[model samples]
Target: MIRTGNEYREGLKDGREIWMDGEKVTDVTTHPAFKPIVDVRARMYDMQHDPAYKERMTYRDNNKTNPVLYKLPHEQKDWADKLEAVDAVMNDIGGVVTRVGDETIGEMWSLCDGRDVLASIDDRFSDNIDRHIQAVTDNDIFHVSANTDPKGDRSLSPRDRDPDMMVHVTRETDAGIVIRGAKFETAAAYADQAFLKPTVGAWADEELSDYAVGCIVKMGAPGVKHICRSGFAGKSRAADYPLSNKFDEVEALVVFDDVLIPWEDVFFYRHTKAAQYVRSSLHRYSAFPYVLRLLYVADMMIGTALWNARQTGLDKLQAVREKIADLVCYREGINAHLTASIAAAQRSPGGLLMPHQSMLYAGRVFAVSQLQNMMHIARELCGGQICITPNADSFEADGSGEWLNKFYSLNQRWQADDRRKLLAFARDLLNSDYAGHRLTFVQFAQAPHFSHLAAVYQSFDFEGPLDFVRKSAGLSDQVKG
Candidate 1:
C-alpha cells in the first residue's frame, strides 16, 4: 500500500537514536542536518498521491496501489516504468537522490537471483528474501543499505583483529540472531530499514563465519545507534549553497550493539558461501539506477556550463563551443549505454528483465571514472568567476551592492542579480564543499573503480572474441589445449 508524506514522517518518530556533532537528534524530520533530505523523501511519497503524478509514480496491482519503483522487473516495461518513475521524482524534487527507494530496491533482487543457492544453505533464507521483497511493496518502506565496515587492519582476518571491526552475529536467541559491530552507511538515520550484509566476495576459507550474516536491521530498533558525519545543510545560506541546503542526504556510522534481528528478517547467517554469493551478484539490478543517476549529474554540469557561456556570449568562440560539446558527448555517452542496456535487455536467472550486464557495468565505469575530469571541464567553462564571486550577503549590502551591480551586470537581459545568481549556482554545483563530497560519493560510495572493471570482466561473454581469434589463427584447436 502507498503511504502519504505525513505517514512517512510519522514513521521516523519511533525514537530511533540519531546523533550528530556530539549531540542527540530527537527528530530527523526537523533536524537541520537531516530534515532537508527527509523532506525530499517525504515529498516523493506525497507526489505518489498527487493526481498529476500518480499515473507515472504508481500503478494498480492486485487491486492495491503500489509505488512503481518497487515492482519487480518481470518484463522490459517494468524497467522502463522504473526509469520514468525515478525521472518523475527527480524532476519534482529538483535534484538526484541515490539511496531513496529506487536505487536500493533492486538489491533484494540480487538475493532473489540467488534463491536456489541460498535454499541449498537453508530453505528459510530463500523464503525470507521473497517475503521481504513483497513486504517492501506492501508496506511502502524506505530502505537503505549497509555493507562497508571500519577496516582497522587490511591484513588481519576478522578473528585476528578487533571483532567489532566487522558486523557479525554474536549469538542466536529464541527470538533471532543478535548482531554486534558497526557499518558505514548513507541515509541510515532517516530510512526505515537497511539490508545489512558483508562488503565483498572474499570470505576467506572459513566455511562458517560469524561475520557472514545478512538481515534487515530496523533503523528504530533498540541498541541501534546512528552517529552521523557533519552535514552541509546549515553551514551556509541556501542562496550560496542551494543543493547542499535542500538535498543533503546525511550519512552515519551505524552501530549495532547486540541488536536482535527477527528470524524472518535474517536472510542468511554463518554461511561463507551464502555471503560470497550475495556479494558477487549484489549489484545485478541495482546498478542500473545507480549509474542512471549520473545522467542527471551530467545534465547539471552541461546546463550550468552552457548557461554561463551563453550569458557571456562565449558561445561564439570555437574553443568554448567545443568544451560545451565535450560535456554533451559525455552526457550522451551515459544516455547511449542506458538506452542500449535496455534495448538489449536480457532475462536474468530469476526471470526478471535485467539490463544488459556488460553494457550496464561498462557504463558505470565510464560515468564514474570520468566524473572529475568532466567537473574540471565544467569548472573551466564557468571561468574563474565562480570561485571569486562575492557571497550573497555582499550582493545584498547597500554599499557593496552598487559596486557589485556595476561589475557583475553583463547586459540589460542578464542583469547583476541574474548573473550573480547563476554564478552562485555554478559555484555550489562545481566548486563548493558539497561538490567535492558528491564527487567522492559518486566514485566510492557504491564500489570502487577496480570493482567496476571486475564486474565488467565477470559479466562479459569473452568466448566470442576467443573463438574468432582461434578460427582466424588456424592453429588454435591444437594450441588451445
Candidate 2:
C-alpha cells in the first residue's frame, strides 16, 4: 500500500485550483513556491522504498507493507515505532516540515474515540468514521485538518452577520450536502484531502445549527479555491536562506463555494453535541507530533550557539558555558515531558493507546510558550555578525573579497568561507523574516496561548492537589462531599 515518490507527485495533477502571488499556479509539483516542499514530501515517500530505510519507515501487515506513520495505534510499541519513523524522516530531510502527513492523521483518531457520542445522534455517522480511517491507510493518502474559520464581527452572530463566515450546510441533497464558507489551512494546497470541522464557538447550548457540521473534503473537487500567501522560496539565493528555500510550507485561505459532501463522507451534521466533542478532543493524539517538532528546533538552536562559541573560543569562559546550559535545560525539559507521557500512556475510549493527556499538554505549552526567549538566547550567543555579515557573493567579489577574507578568517581551523556559511545559516534560523514567521507558526499553528493553557487546565488532575491541602490543613470531612 506504500506509494512511490512519482506516484505521489502524479496525484497532484487533478486540476485543483490554486493561486499564489497574484497568479495561478499551473502545477504545484513544479511551481517555484511549492516545488521544494513538494519534493521534501516526495522524498519521504521514496525513503519507504529504499533498502536502508524500508525496515525503519514501514511495517508489515499480513503480506502487505504499509507506512508506519499511518498505522493505527493499538499498543505502546506502536507509538514507539511511529516516533522512530518520524526521527528517520526528519534526519534524512535535514529540516523539520509539519503537516506533511503523520502530524494530521491523529485528528481522525480523535473522531474515532467519539463514535459512541456520534452514534447517539446517528448510527450512520459512526459507520462513516470507521470507513474513513481505513481508507487513509489503504490508499496511502495525505490528509490535513481544517478547523479555524474566518469569523467576522465577533459582536454579531453568524446568522446576524455574514452566514458564510463559518462553514455551514446550506442545503441537503439526496446525494449529499452543500457547504459554504472558508477555512485557514496550512497545507491544503497540495494535500489530498482535509478533515473539515467547526471552529471553536458556543455550540454546546444549541441543539441544532448549520455551523455544527464535520465531514471529509476533497481538495480537487469543484468550488474549492486555494488562495495562498506569498512564499519565501525563490525570493533569494538558497545560499543565504537555506531553511526558507527548502522548508516553507505555504498556508492558504481555502474558499469552499458551495462544495458538495457525499453521504458516505459525512461524519456528523446539524448536531451541536458532536461539534463540541470534536472541538474539545481535536488534538488528543496529534499534539504529540506537533510538540515533537519543537525538540528538533531546540537542537538546531543549541547546535548553532555551540558551534559559534567554539569558532570564537568563547566556550572557554564560565559565563558562556552557563548560557549554553540554560539552552540545554529548555531542551531537556521538553524531552522529559515527552518521555514520561509515553511511559505513563493511557488507553483511549476507542481502545487505542494515547500519550498521557496532562503531560502531553504541559509539554506543548512549555515548548511553544518559551520559543521566543530560547531563540533570543541562541541569537545573543551567535553575536551581531549573523545580521551584519555579507552574503556569499560579497565574499567572492574581487575588492571586497580580500577585506572580507582578512576579517572573517579567525584561525587556521576557522577559514573565511566556513565562517560565512555558518553565519548565513544562523541568520536564517534566528534573525530572518522567515524566522519570525516560524515563531508565529509555532505559537498559533496548533492554537493560541490561551488555548494551550486551557488544554492544561482541563486535563490536569485538580482533585489530587485539593485532597492534599484538605488533609494537611485538617479541613472538615463535609468538604469531601
In model 1, the clashing pairs are none
Write model 1 residue lDDT over 1-481, tens digit each, in one string: 9999999999999999999999999899999888899999999999999998999999898899999999998888988898899899888888878989878878898899889987988898899999999999989999889989996797986689899998989999999999999999999999999999887758768889999998999999999999999999989998888898987888899999999999999999899888888877888988899999999999999999989998999988999999989999989999999999999999889888889999999999999999999999999999999999998899999999899999999998899998988898888888988889899999988798889999999999988888788888885486552
Please give, for residues 1-481, the per-residue lDDT of candidate 2 as tens digits.
8999899899999999999988999999999999999999999999999998999899988888899999898888888998899999999999889999889999999999999988998898899999999888877888999888999998987889899999999999998999999999998999999999999887866799999999999999999999999999999988999999999999999999999999899999899999999988988999999999999999999999999999999998998889889889999999999998899999999999999999999999999998999999999999999989998889889999999999999999999988988899899999998899999999988889888989899888898898989889999867972
Worst 10 residues of 2 by lDDT: 472-481
Highest lDDT against the true fold, candidate: 2
Pairs in clash, predicted candidate 2: none
TM-score of each: 0.99, 0.98
Lowest lDDT 10-residue stretch of candidate 1: 472-481
| Candidate 2, position 373, lDDT | 97
